[model samples]
Target: MNMMSMSKLSLLSVLLIAHCSTAASDLPKDVFILAGQSNMAGRGGVSSGKWSGDVPPECKPDPSILRLNAKLSWEVAHEPLHSDIDVGKTCGVGPGMAFANEVRLRANESKIGVVGLVPCAVGGTKISDWEKGTRLYSELLRRAHVSVSGGGVIRAILWYQGESDTVKKEDAQAYQGKMKKFIMDLRSDLNNPSLLFVQVAIASGEGRFVDSVRKAQLGINLPFVKCVDAKGLRLKDDHLHLTTMSEVHLGIKLAHAFLTTLK
Candidate 1:
């Protein structure tokens, strides 16, 4: 190639590298994965097929807090945080925004920069649906990798699920084992053996085996894991999902667990 052609090619390469560097630098420095089912996807202030459109102060959107949108890009996070990711579900308030806001407030003294939440929860999904090879699992891992692909660091995964598992006696009985495997496989895939996990023990379920599932949740003895009980949190009229206030409380609890225990 002539010097003119080579020089043009070198300029193009330099521009490409500069563009990539800028994009990577724009990514959040602290990333957290939010995964689970309906409750995790959020049902607060949601009844029938609609959300009340009310966002509590604790769960308000913050410019410093970002969410990995369904398009796999970062945007300032707001309430109904899972709306885009959960798709068909009428997402109201989830622990994600509140949790992120709380973390940001408390971590102001630390060097914890921008906070990014990767929402991967699907409403009404069972633990079985999130097995290593399942769609939920794959999407979750994919989103996770994408979240941190641009030089961001995955701080932890905030989990709240298992209500679906309470539907059957056998499922409840096997909850602990499945849950443990899920956590292990996730950490293995993420290649972070010490990745933090803050799980919310179920407060209500669609079936009779609520206690059994909660027992399994609290019974988990894995390292770098913390379980926050939602036993006394208020539920909605349906007696299945938490109320708006309860979601806020749960978010605070999750934040406390992460800040005080896991951090």
Candidate 2:
């Protein structure tokens, strides 16, 4: 090739490298994954002008909290954090923002770097739906690996599911085993065997096996895993989801569990 053509090609390669570097630098180094069912997707009432009811100020968005958007890009995180997940017609408050806010507060002298929350939860989903190699698993795992590859960190995965399993005795009976396998597989795939896995016990449901799911949740005892109770948390009018306030509380609980693991 002539010198003119070679020079132009070199310049183009330089520009491309710079652009890629800039994008990777923009990614957050601290990220949390939010995964589970409706409660995790959240049906808490909204008060925003764009939504149905009211969302308290505390539950509102914070600049410090960031999320992986539909385009797989980092953006300011807000309620209904998992909109792209198709969990609801409109997003409402979830524990993500709350948990993130609390994490920032407790980061101590070390400044909390940019926080990225990866919302992969699908409402009404059962534990079986997230089995390794399943569609949901692949999607979630893909998102996470992409985030990490882009220089973002995978600090923890906050899971709040199990309601759907409450509908069947067999589902409930096998909940513990399924849940244990999911966590192990998830950590293994992430290549972080000691990754902190924080989970919220089934808090809202209407089925004969509700308590069974709860019992299974409580029975989970894995290293680097912590399960927070949610059985007594108040629910919304539907009685199948957590109330806005309860979600906030649950977020705090999750944040505490996650932080404790870091110690």
Best model per TM-score: 1
lDDT tens string, model 2, 1-263? Answer: 99999999999999999998886666778888889887888777843423454656656777667788768877888877877774455557788888888888886743567788998988778999999989999999988987777776798899999889988899999999999999999999999999888888877665778889989888888988889988789987777888788989999898888777666
Q: After superposition, how far is residue 52 of candidate 1 from its true place, in Å?
A: 1.9
Number of clashing residue pairs, candidate 1: 0
TM-score of each: 0.91, 0.87
The backbone clash count of each candidate, in order, is 0, 5
Candidate 1, residue 89: the lDDT equals: 74
Q: Give the runs in model 2 whose Cα sits over 4 Å from its true position.
A: 1-23, 46-50, 87-89, 109-111
Write candidate 1's Cα lDDT for 1-263 as tens digits.
Answer: 99999999999999999998886676799999999988888888888889989888898888789899999889989878899988977898988888887888887654678899999999888999999999999999999999988788998899999889888999999999999999999999999999999999999888999999999999999999999999999888888888888888888888888887533
Backbone clash pairs in model 2 (N, Cα, C under 3 Å; residues 3+ apart or in different chains), count: 5
Off by over 4 Å in 1: 1-23
Candidate that would win on lDDT: 1
Residue 44 of model 1, lDDT score: 89
7 Cα displacement, candidate 2 (Å): 13
Residue pairs clashing in model 2 are 46-53, 46-54, 47-53, 47-54, 47-55
